[model samples]
Target: MAITQPEEDIEPTGTKTKWQRFKSKYFRMKMLIWWTLLGVALGIILGAALYSVHPSSVVITLIGYPGELLIRALQELVLPLMVFALMSGVFNLRHSGSGTGRIIRWSLLYYLLSMILAVILGIALVFIIRPGRSRPFAANNFANCNSNVTATGATRADKSAVDSLLNIGRDIIPTNIVAAAAAPNFLGVITFAIVFAAGLITFGQRAEPLIQILEMCNEVFMKIIYAVIACTPIGVASLLASTILKSCSIISLLKALALYVATVLGGFLIHSFVLLPLTLIVLSQNNPIKVIRSFLPAIFVGVGTSSSAATMPVTMKCGEDYGCVPSIVRFVVPMGTNVNRDGAALYEAVSVIFIVQAHGLTLSVGNVIVVALTATLAAIGSASIPNSALVSMITVLQALSLQEYIPDVAVLYSVDWLLGMIRTATNIWGDACACVVVDTWARRHAKKNGTLPIKNPEPPAEQEMAMGVDSSKKDEVI
Candidate 1:
């Protein structure tokens, strides 16, 4: 007989090599890098093309509308799923009686503190960098671009700082859930989810069946999300191709583009890379680099899509993979994606300052305060829906009665896709950081209390029976 090598050895090695290649190809890092470059090129070319066209044409609107529609479909799924998933998860934890209250309190405190710190850092950076002072282009070039462009007939109004704050508070509560859901207001969805989740928890074990059903529903919804993400490359390609077809000389808008890009990058580096990591190291004793490394996929998708809502599923997955409890990831990340917008907050602040300085308008102390408050509230009020920020930013400017000085919102709209990616990436980074902090705290608390954290204990009878089986087996062998 001819010498026959062991088939098993050859088969296993070949299989292993194929599996390794597959994993690397599907790795989030590779996906992120490739998609992000595609998005950037598309945004620059399309933005320039849109700018070049004198009068708005039907072709530009046709190509742009599909991208906008895809964003809307994505937004429709965000709020209901977030509400259902978060409420079910939170209520489940509450039932476990495993120090969930402490975790929630700590996470909330971190979110609030981080928001304030982001604002402070943004204002300080704007003052230091003086991004407004770098007037590489003539003001005249942008003057025609400054005319007020509003869909609604509302004119810019003059309002006191107090009035603006009151308005923001008033808008937070949704009068009708149906209306809010249809329009897809994130704040309203969050409010509804928290209340609903709290009610389920208060009912205790009586709500267990309902919670289980909701968990099933959450899984179904996630599968739907996966399907959507699979189609991302096609949506992205159409969006980019249309952008390129419209803009011929895309390279000319580099100066203003550079300023906008630098502001976002600088802010993200400081908050995500430096400030947030330092906080985690000191308070939670976790390695900052490990946390960053764990969140690479979420960060990449966030930047690529520029929609925090779009990046939610990936963010949750990354958090779970990084040793976070599923309950924590389910609850914290969705909420953080909507409310904790460090990058968007920074962008709004810097953009307002840049616009004012560009137009030679000096902001008073009161104006600066109003800008900060407006940016924070606007960031909070932003619908997780795509392109919603464009409209919302206008509302914010109008709220401050500063719309006239910064009348044309389209100036910022031009670079919105690019900025959205950065903002979403920062939001995901914050969410991952929150997960790590909360997980570490929960683990330490459980260890100190001499109890297993959030996991079911073995039944006494089952434990004894297992021991008896082992003893009997040993006797037989002897």
Candidate 2:
């Protein structure tokens, strides 16, 4: 008697081949994190080797061109990505109605609270470490600072706290949408997206077609972002290499900034590892370590790119992979990029105080209060781009009537590349934590009220192909 073939043996050859192809693609995607790590290591090694030989400007530029291209490509994607992501998220939340407002309020409260804690931690650390005491900076460093200032025709005027508040107000309500987008006034862009989405929801069924379009656009942009992210390892390697070559001559400056660096880094470590994680655990009851492990891909990209705005796409993807609902990921992450800048606030607070101590000036109680307030406000208003903190730090100094010490800001800028990377990583980490908190809260609130739709189960295989690499899936995928 003839026996029927086994089910596995009888599977369609074409279907079997498709599955094999998917598995291969999945393997490559899963290895991206490891490839990124290798890129960082190679970048350090190559950069260090070239720095010893004193690479010329042309060489540095040539090595860094690909990185510059990567930045431009990511920036090109940011405005559209932010708009679509925010609008889609809001439209989806329209089903929950009042729940939308609650999420927004919760997001803002978390942003404000986290940043305040970070600033407080930074201020305390700087006072304890006293990095600026004894004016550790060398004479040549001052000369370099002064000459750079003069050469650039730099001028500073004291700005009142009220002016800073007014500037933020103006940015929040841009007269021209095109100008706001071009100015890359992200806060304005964010304000517009939220309002536009609200208007769409107001029109109800009339806006259904538009909402579908937005969801489709978001999917398309996300695909484009993944294509760009595929190039991250190469881009990161070039960026790090160029940065190393540029900083080769700053060996002495690094030594002088040792204590200053320690204080800043110490504050960041506490904020990132201790305070933020505890917030996640206590508030969400989710394992912080597991969440952080899920966030590793975004963290590495943020560190390499050094711009939270640039890293937004990756952050959103990671959030989704970690099982956060897309609505929360899209809304909270974009807002957090602009508002929840714990690292920037912390860095600015430490910086102004360190400068005061370095210049041998005592801060009155009023001045210290001003520093804390201005640093917090400035960070809230700062752009999510590289080196933007430097501009906001000026506001802090001017508010405290420390314009003379403004020139010393140049010394800090010299080492900002390294610090910028570390702080950017911290900022991205904080954003992920905020997502966890908001998503958990929203799920619970929805459950109690029975108003909001529950999140779906993990996406299907096609969607799973785009998911962030998780620590748990390392064996199966990697």
Candidate 3:
């Protein structure tokens, strides 16, 4: 016989070496992280050097254009992703062992509990830290920025807390679904999705083909987001740099706002890294670190993007990949992106407290409690978009009739983009945790009802040990 090599002996055609594969697959992503860090470093350095430059200068504007485009792209993806992803979620719940109604109940319960806890934590932290009020430099140094911010907020803040709360509910019930869809009101769009999904589930088996179409649409949107996300390093660098260039003076900005920044970020770190992870441990009865590791990809993406609406696809994928039930993954994640805003709730409460304190006012125990409650409600009404918290912070400020204090919101606004990323990442993590909780409940519920279809892995090995199969027999079978 000819000396011919076996197929296994031959190297696979078109297969790249390990180094080349790593270069192709991970080079851009690794670069993205390093560049973002570099951007922040460079931003602060260049900002200090260029403090004399005006924000509207051609160079700053051009550098900012990429970041602006990224925001616009996120806006474009928001509506369709919410509608179709939620539709897919409902579709899966209806088909999976856990039916749609049960998943909805699980989703809402987790969402509400998360929001309430987050709001309370946020208010309590700000109260204890006393960031803005303790700092004298910030109030005295940024007179122009503060004045401009005050003028913008005063006009819209005439309503009381009660009035704002009442109006917040009304915004959820949009006048026309079409207008909501086009204007891309996340709350309205989410409501429309639920009703439409309920109608489809009413069709039962007939909805299968339509659900497949939606599944495909969801995948397409996810791919698009991934592609757009690759551009984030440049976009983030541009955005942060632009923010720096717009500053009146770096030393003044830092001295004035350092305490407020620390308070907000410290609270987020405590909540996200400590309290929230501990809650996950209690709920899932699993290693919280392992659970968090499963979702790191999505978390990083959310941090980069700073919008839950934009981060939905990655959030959904993370849940599924973590082995959550399909129904829970679909329903819980989409709904969570819209409603499970633990971090946003926390941020808004802190922002309100920081602003109130910075303006040389104080809230009593009763008023502090009320602000916490109002902040939780406002977060529910707010879109899962960047700077929407600023929009709703007006309601909280107006309710207190400290509309004059609104100007200091500008200090908070100075670092909103970077702060938005941290909070948004925390928000996505909450949503992922909710998925795990819902999945755990659904699995238990299904098992109780004897409908759970548990997939058996390493069944052969397990049975081998249990049945005492001989090694020879095992080898023969193999």
In model 1, the runs with Cα more than 4 Å from the true position are: 1-56, 88-92, 98-100, 119-157, 182-185, 225-253, 277-478
Candidate 2 lDDT, tens digit per residue, 1-478? 9999763344443444334543544354345445555556666677778877776678888887776776667557756765776676556545543325677778878888889999999999998988866543322222243222221112222344466456665766899989877765655666788799888888878887888888789778867766776676676678767765655244533454788999999999999999999899788999999999999998997877677766666788889899987766766786787677999999999999887765445665545666787687667655565555755676666555455455455456445767888888999999999999988998898789876543322222332232321222211210
Q: Which 10-residue span in candidate 1 carries the lowest summed lDDT? A: 469-478
On residues 231-261, what C-alpha lDDT tens digit does candidate 3 reach at each position?
A: 6555556665665565555554465467777
CA lDDT, every model vs. true structure:
0.58, 0.69, 0.62
- Segments of candidate 3 deviating more than 4 angstroms: 1-31, 53-63, 98-108, 123-148, 182-184, 255-261, 272-478
Ranking by lDDT: 2, 3, 1
Alpha-carbon shift of residue 413 in model 1 (angstroms): 12
TM-score of 2: 0.55
Expressed as tens digits, the lDDT of each residue in 29-144 for candidate 1 is 33543544455455545555566553344665565565555445555554545556556445434533343557567776777677667777877777676654533222333333
lDDT of 3 at 247: 50
lDDT of 2 at 25: 40
- Each prediction's TM-score versus the true structure: 0.55, 0.55, 0.57
Q: Which number leads on TM-score?
A: 3
Error of 3 at 33 (Å): 2.7
Q: After superposition, how far is residue 58 of candidate 2 from its true place, in Å?
A: 32
Q: List clash counts for every candidate, in order.
A: 3, 0, 2
- Superposed on all Cα atoms, model 1 deviates from the true structure by an RMSD in Å of 10.4
